[model samples]
Target: MRLTALALLLALPALRADEGMWTFDNIPVQKIKAKYGVALEPSWLKNLQLATVRFPNGTGAFVSRDGLVVTNHHVGRDAIAQMSTAAADLVRDGFTAATRAQEIKVPGLELMMLVSMEDVTAKVNGAVKPGATDQEALTARRNALADLRKADEAKTGLTCEPVTLYQGGEYWLYRYRKFTDVRLAAAPELQVAAFGGDPDNYTYPRHNLDFALFRVYEDGKPYRPDAILPFSAKGASMGELTFISGHPGTTYRQQTHAQMAYARETGIPFQLRAIERQKQALLALSATSPEARRLAAEAIYSLENGHKRLSGQLLGLSKPENLAKVAEAEAALKAAVAKDPALQARVGGSWDRVAQAVARQKALLAEATYLDTGRATLVGRVAALRHAIALVRLADETAKPSAERLSEFSEGNLKATRAQLLSPRPVHKAIDQALLAAGLEEARQALGDGHPFVKAVLGGRTPEAVAKAAVEGTKLDDAAVRRQLAEGGKAVLDASADPMIRLAKAIDPFSRAIRKQMEAEVTGVFNEQGGRIAEARFKVFGKALYPDATFTLRLGYGPVATYANGTGTLAQPFTTYMGMFDRHLGWGGNAAAAEGGVWTLPQRWLDRQVKLDLATPFNFIYACDTVGGNSGSPVVNVKGEFVGINFDSVYEGQGGYYVYDADTKRAVATDVRAILEALRKIMDAGHLADEALGK
Candidate 1:
């Protein structure tokens, strides 16, 4: 959901009661026609119902025309790397197709289209009732959706997926046809593709030029499928109806206030804390281990970016003005519910229950933070125990025949384990020590060493002694450890001689008991007030709502321009080569200089007087709604012609996922002209330029 802080700043002017229904789906087609003076096309509606291409990890776009397809540079980077060699690093040097034959093929990459959608809401909800617990409802809904998907897949040639659109009940089966032959047509240098680096990410006045071109091939030729649509640069008519067809991941708009409150209080904070820890962990490890550094780079970037965005949302929610708006909206909803006897009877207590839940969990909110740190200490011991058990199983199973040996040993398990141990911040020592200490303390406090599991694991040794040996004496590199399990086989499994194994057996039941206790306490409070809040929210916001975005395709539109939010005026559209030079100069404590950094352009750029390009005002900003998943989305003119590629939104704009404003809702997009110019001249990727521009 968009953060309430930004929502308050861009609050729509109060509208008459009648205007509410106009934006809602209830309004007739004629009413929209009369107001917007444009006929809503049946084709547009059909297109809206279609799904855009999406990769396994959320990267894809529709087939635009014939073989032409669009997606983000970052998304296609892996494929580009796979197709490249040290002598031809597409990521650093970029690629361009001078002609159709020169296009680079990406093996195993694919495109998918949503061919059909069936509303399965009734089937899902029928499995569980209104009074059912969340877990029960979730399980029931999942099972029903699975059954529905299986049935649909049997009938249709395409793959069918049953998706929950609005939490548990609102479900739809989206059918898709997959194509696996996609190729790269063009790309830009990292300098241009990720222009602003980390600082400009998720912020406005974005200088990023994040776009990549690819094409779909079938039978060794350009695929001209029926799904491809011709590019239309004119865009939709101003003030006219338009529809965006894409795979929108998730939205939180439909969430009850109680759920949102949970997010605001418990969920977001926990996420922030976890992210912080991860970032720190990555940095510490990266400082020493080159392999670890490379492996953690992507993870660190994702975590840091998410942390920044969520932090913005939390700050937005904390604003007094925003809270007031929420309260006012809730009050109005309650009034509406009180007026409707039926609704009141159905949802009267929901809000109170939700509130009680929130109140009860207030103290326990920090539990997640504690667990985040604690888990790092516990997981290693668990892993060691599991590894030992696996070895014993492998030995027992190998007695049948040489060919019957378990696959685990031949696999990369040992190699991966060694690499993990070599990481600068290996978790083994800490985890073993923490688990050993905690287990011993618990045994002493509860049943003493007499408890069978405790006696088997720790009866002969003190906690301190075990901890010291585990932390300082244990050698992860010891071959004997692997051999001992390999030889012992069934004997090890039958005996409880291993302390780690004994502790591991007890941990699950202990953890479950703790979780149950916590849930019971929380649910009891929720049963009191949660229901009342949910009902109140529904009355105020109505049934049609958006869910939280899960980094999926969503269409957001606004104008082009910069914004001022006390951080300093963000120059809209873009920063020029001159500005890049200036930034470098400032960084080097020489801002007054005219020429001394990476921005020193090629002779051609200089010959053009730099002013020719910088002064042309080639860029425009808009409060277009976007999020992380929105990256690489085409920023089109009203006629739906691609003008630029959407990359990042500003920090202030992070909250825009929920609430959009005509102001402050800007996305960073690379201008099509600049991209073309870079390809044609700077990068000498004339072939790619020709295909992209249809030259």
Candidate 2:
């Protein structure tokens, strides 16, 4: 009991207080009871787990028995954009289906709910010897995990995902039921749903109603769900215990200082610059026409969101407090390992090995960012380079025996891959060509004017000309054309005449080689050495610490609380509808609105204001830990009563992905009362509101 004595001696409040994004199976029962004097029953835990669903991009919660899921408006934006048109722009005006028949089916929209979980650490680690090279161990682990997943899927007919927890210190086989037929039910206008723009995002005392509704359908009818979160008419109160249930995407809490520095310097900065450039390109394109504006709206939103998120993340990372905390945690981990003779012998030098790999990877990052990750600005993310790689990889991987290919191309993921590759999404040639050129140019700049890939991509042609040749020459816009090539395999790729196909074929060898190199140098070392560090941590902190987020179901509990609102200002925990209107008018560009820009309330909402209670809660702040993927999570009380819907974390909480600062970090959510009020008063969504409230 390395940690037991330290736990008692230090009496650390971080471990005791409401913290951690805990897996459903690993709830801190004693801690919860101690903090709130409330007990969570087994049945309640199961129900809560079932109620939460993982949308492709974010989290959602079941609000009705017929599988009506509520998620952030941003999460559902893609579906909405796809369903919208120039005439009936569902995204701009917002939409509310008066009847089930009127609800529009969103093609390729998918969600997943965790059905069961089983520990599989032993099976995964079974193949590796006590001591082995990082690459050997990683290759064995990946192959084993894939084989296990394939077997489980074949046996249970469920989506079997092998989740590596604590950076592979633990592993679990989580089975999920996938829902592909999701339909848009009701959504508010874009203007109101995202009431405040980028400036308001990640801010507290917010009034935005950032929520949307979708329904899961099976066999042409609404699916009856076994679990649902019942919404309360009354909102949450200050200092009350709060819980957030959702699928948080990713966190790098256990990364060493060197790795974090790489992110802070090369990775994050490069991404921010890329996003800013993309934002400008999108805006410039969207200004061409009203329809162009409509189609590019979601892209613009994504760009802005990314820009703000990365900026905030950098701010958090730069903070002395966060840096000091990381150093302290790293020091403690090292000390813990040194105290245990066996562990010290096993992992004492793991960190140095990781540092060497990090240094190597840092040099490759710029090229990797462009060619491998396809983050290159000139070629853009969705251009010919990726499309080419997909075709080549598909051909190469599918040529191998089903079990030999990577998990991404394995038998278990074919359906998902096909759905994405062959989905009938609209395309704007101008946007495509522009972004493609940007990515290509970025490749040239990062790699060099004389780089082989750049030369091949350019093919002695101008970047714009090459881009036009690729976009206009490729038949990938047609799903059937893509399917034919994908099914044709390597021989077909070799024989193909399509410009994009030929380009992919030419670059495939180089890209594949780099990928292989990356698999060994960076990913392998990080996972192999990171697992050792995690073991060291477990020795010191034991099971008291929670694993990092991995885009899975988790719950983080804290208190509904207030904090300093920056510059010695005391911020309130909650905001009301009255404050919303007051701020709107104050900042609505009238004579009194010296703060700038106009914000208008809908005429319907304005007319109904007299009949409604302006005092109703609009948004609230809580101490729950959250990150980007936690959007649309259900914010509830200890008894599992819905109080709000999570959409953003306060600026201070940007560090939440790496550290939880109880003093300043807070989760910002739209009050359930606000959603209900808007539905009943503004949107005339009375029936839907009644159903959510069980009234």
Candidate 3:
């Protein structure tokens, strides 16, 4: 759809020049042509979209026709960790397969590439009858979506996912070609990949290498892709036009003021506290021994990254100016709706409905957050209790009809769900005990010790005692046991004697109750009423407004440019390899110890420093609108050549969740030139370099 002048004029007060994670089907080609004098042809967009692949947690793209994929090390962290053992420690030493047979098949890893998408908004909305109750409407919509997905999958034999756009204002059926047998082709050491660690995570002028390579396989051979992004040796220049293609996780830019308030006042605080408790436990565990640190490394890194991101988001939301801007934009939109009789009549009470949903959310927050049924799928971090919960829920959910089953258990998602449950990923009992004990205590405090859930879970024992027994006594840790229980169905689940399973069974009722309450009261209202509000927005501003991100494929364009650091200094867009060494040696008065730790240079890099081009761009910043899930995105120029891989965002970019400020916000990426240089000189992977550069 073309963005009209009326749309631009109406949205200019809120939307900026470089704002928007645009959908592939609705890209503003004319706008790009007019602004950058670069014509974005249909073939260019199509190839880019097809090459990009989605991981369980992040994004990547095909870098070679022979199925070599490039993404961030962090995005591939879980796979690397799974491939590591006490004997090998792949995460510490990194891995490179010199031959096709040598490539280690990563267990339970999957990559999905988008094949096509079709708008199904009318078909979904048509499910709801004229005056149905919210719950009925929600149920009908789910049934309709289920039918559509099942039919499409049967007909096409592809993974058909229903992607909710604009909060339910529209729905798109995204069909993907799934690749299950993914292998690790190359990965850098943890120290180099995550250099400067948590301190430099969300800050710019970053020097982390942060890139990894993978290859998808079919029948034990490399899977060739139809489209691949050619690696560019020249890379991106300062102020040059660039585009990022990836899946950005989530954003609340379209949220109402009440919803934002709920997030600020209630939701984020609860999550922050929960993460703090878990992080402290992991840190204490890490301090014990080298082995302990190895076991807890991925979890600690993830928690620390999340803590910083959420803290920045909270700070941004707390700022008076930011809040006032959100309020003003919402007010303007509402006022515009009020002035238009047709829009007012259509969406008169949408704001109030969303506010009411927020109130319901606040009332149920404690129960809903703590008793969450699906938390175990987080890279298998949680202990037996969460796994037990998954088993119990699966037994129940799988028994229901396809249309009536929970979304996670739907036909389209069952394969991934089953894969996650049966994954043979290593689990550390001690660390699990600590985290589980912490979670139990947190629940006790939040829901009160007298609460039914707390009572059922604790069962008159201390949180520590319960967690110890659950982790030590449960056989759910064994993949075979989980498989048996999963395949045996409810009778087997009901007969299981495992402490964790018993506990899961004990608390299953309360969990289901809260989940039902959440679905009927909070989520249903948000979707139904939120759709109306979206309609009101479209009526006022037209279709030019981008939808909130839903972790689906999107294309964002920007320029390689510097920005003010908010401290009377202009932060440069590029950082050189010399800067990385200086930071390691504490030459900038940075706190990284000169002798060792995360900032310490890898031995190979230190040995090859004289052979390297110190002036080569190591990392650079761009003004692209990005969020968490865009981490491994391939940043390409107009010619569709890969110049860099997007990794982190500066602290200021955290506010991009609600607003895009091109002045201060910057997306950080590793320069393709740096990757090439390191591969050729320092890493002793010239063959890999040759392949990447298409030699």
Model 1 earns a TM-score of 0.67
Q: Give candidate 1's total backbone clashes.
A: 45
TM-score for every candidate vs. truth?
0.67, 0.93, 0.94
Per-residue lDDT tens digits for candidate 2, residues 224-308, read 9998888988778877788899988899887887787777777788889888777777788788999888877788888888788
Which stretches of model 1 miss by more than 4 angstroms? Answer: 1-39, 45-51, 56-59, 63-66, 78-90, 96-111, 129-134, 167-169, 218-222, 228-251, 254-266, 289-294, 359-553, 567-619, 657-662
Per-model C-alpha lDDT, please?
0.51, 0.79, 0.84
Ranked candidates (TM-score, high to low): 3, 2, 1
RMSD of 3: 5.1
Tens digits of per-residue lDDT for model 3 on 215-254?
Answer: 9999888998889898998999977889999999999988
Instruction: Locate the minimum summed-lDDT window of 10 residues in model 3.
Output: 8-17
Per-residue alpha-carbon lDDT of model 1 for 1-695, expressed as tens digits?
56984663343321101111111122244544565454556554344324256654344454344567766677676666657664677765677777778888775565666676677776766876678764445445555666666667668867665554433324667777777778888876654565445665665544454667788887887776554323332323212233233343444543445556667777778767656654665576567655444444444556667788888777665555555555666677778888888878866765665566566566554332222112322332334544443444454544554222222222212322333223222224443454445434434444456655345445577865654454454443244554554556656655635544444444433433433444555643342234344445545665543434544334443444446645654343455444543454455523332332222223433344333444322233554555555555555553444565555656765544433333454556555666655555565666555544444
- Going through the candidates in the order shown, the clash numbers are 45, 7, 0
- How much is the lDDT of residue 318 in candidate 2? 79
Q: What TM-score number comes out for model 3?
A: 0.94
Of 2 and 3, the candidate ranking higher by TM-score: 3
